[model samples]
Target: MPHVTATKAMPVPASKAWEFVSNWGGTDKWIPGVGPVVVEGSGIGSLRSADLAPETGFPGRISERLETFDLHKMSFSYCVVGDNPIPITNYLARMSVKAISKDSCEVTWESTWDTELDEAELVVAFNGLYNLALDNVEQLMLSENQ
Candidate 1:
């Protein structure tokens, strides 16, 4: 199993950050070249499919299912379903936000997956993606708060 985690501090309230991150269907807004997310069902157990933009150089569609959701806890768990472009299987990920202060928050994204490929390589790749996404979120939240 390969596991990776990425955490970033955002200059925004936890509530504001959570509202952005918890939108299971709105990932395209902050995940860079990912967009056109289509979701089925709702809440926990809902399924979402996202298409990676062709220019991203890593184009493919990813499907995921919400395994758990807790608005009160500002956290959620999801599992990748069906075929994945990434060379991994049984992928499970969790995301959470914690308040560092009234004006700031910390967000963490972590995942574990089974992979036959190089674990270290995958860890770095996943970490990069998570961190980039978090960075995008932070920028958007700050702009909104201004």
Candidate 2:
């Protein structure tokens, strides 16, 4: 599967930002392929489960189990729950959030899936998601900041 990556900055404290993005269930609001999250345990090793929604090319649900995570490192990793497309399922996607200031943080999304998912197609989908998520977040931050 081809990797999809996008980065965005938010004017919020690192702790606050971490709390928002690190929550598995919280992803539905921003991520395109994710819905609600079910988490168990605690810390990075905590079990995170979520349903991947249908996108442009496909319309089905896929479950992912977050296998690794690190709050201090601002990174997390996950793998597909079931047998999926040979090329699309066998890979990992990681996301990291870094703080640039007390009120500014940047999130970097990266994945290394093994596939030939037309780079352009993946990019187009990701771009829409990234822009939508970022814009929504910025608005949220501004409203909260006020």
Candidate 3:
């Protein structure tokens, strides 16, 4: 299994961070590489399809299902289902926000997947993707507060 984890300090309350990240369907608004996302249903078991931006060099859409949603914990887990553009399978990703202060929180995103590529290669790719997404989240959240 190849895994990648990235974290960033978000200048927002944990609840606010959770409210945005946990909305599975709202990913396109913050994830820089994702195009419009279409989601079906709500809450646990909902499915989300994310289309990758052509500029990212990875074309195609990936569908994932919400596995666990814990608002009180400010965390969620989603597993990739089908139409994955990445060269990996059995992908399970988790995202969470932990409060650092009354109006500050740390967000962490991690994932584990089985890939045909070597572990090092897969890790490098996923790391870049996760870091970019986390940076986007931080920037988007901060700008919204200004």
Model 3, span 10-89: residue lDDT tens: 78898888887887788988776788899999889999998887777678898999999888888999999976888888
| lDDT of model number 3 | 0.87
Per-residue CA lDDT of model 1 for 44-122, tens digit only, reads 8999999887776568999999999988999999999998877889999999999999989999999999999889988
How would you order the candidates by TM-score, starting with the best? 1, 3, 2
Point out the higher-scoring one by TM-score: 2 or 3: 3
Residue pairs in clash, model 2: 1-113, 1-114, 1-115
- Write down the TM-score for model 3: 0.93
RMSD of 1: 1.2
User: Which candidate's lDDT is highest?
Assistant: 1
Candidate 2 is scored at a TM of 0.75
Q: Which stretches of candidate 1 lie over 4 Å from their true place?
A: 55-57
- Write candidate 2's Cα lDDT for 1-146 as tens digits: 46677788887777776776677756667665666767666655455555555553454555567777887888888766565522364667677789999888887766656556576666566557766776666666568768
lDDT of each: 0.91, 0.67, 0.87
Q: Select the stronger candidate by TM-score from 1 and 3.
A: 1
* TM-score list, all predictions: 0.94, 0.75, 0.93
Collision pairs in model 1: none
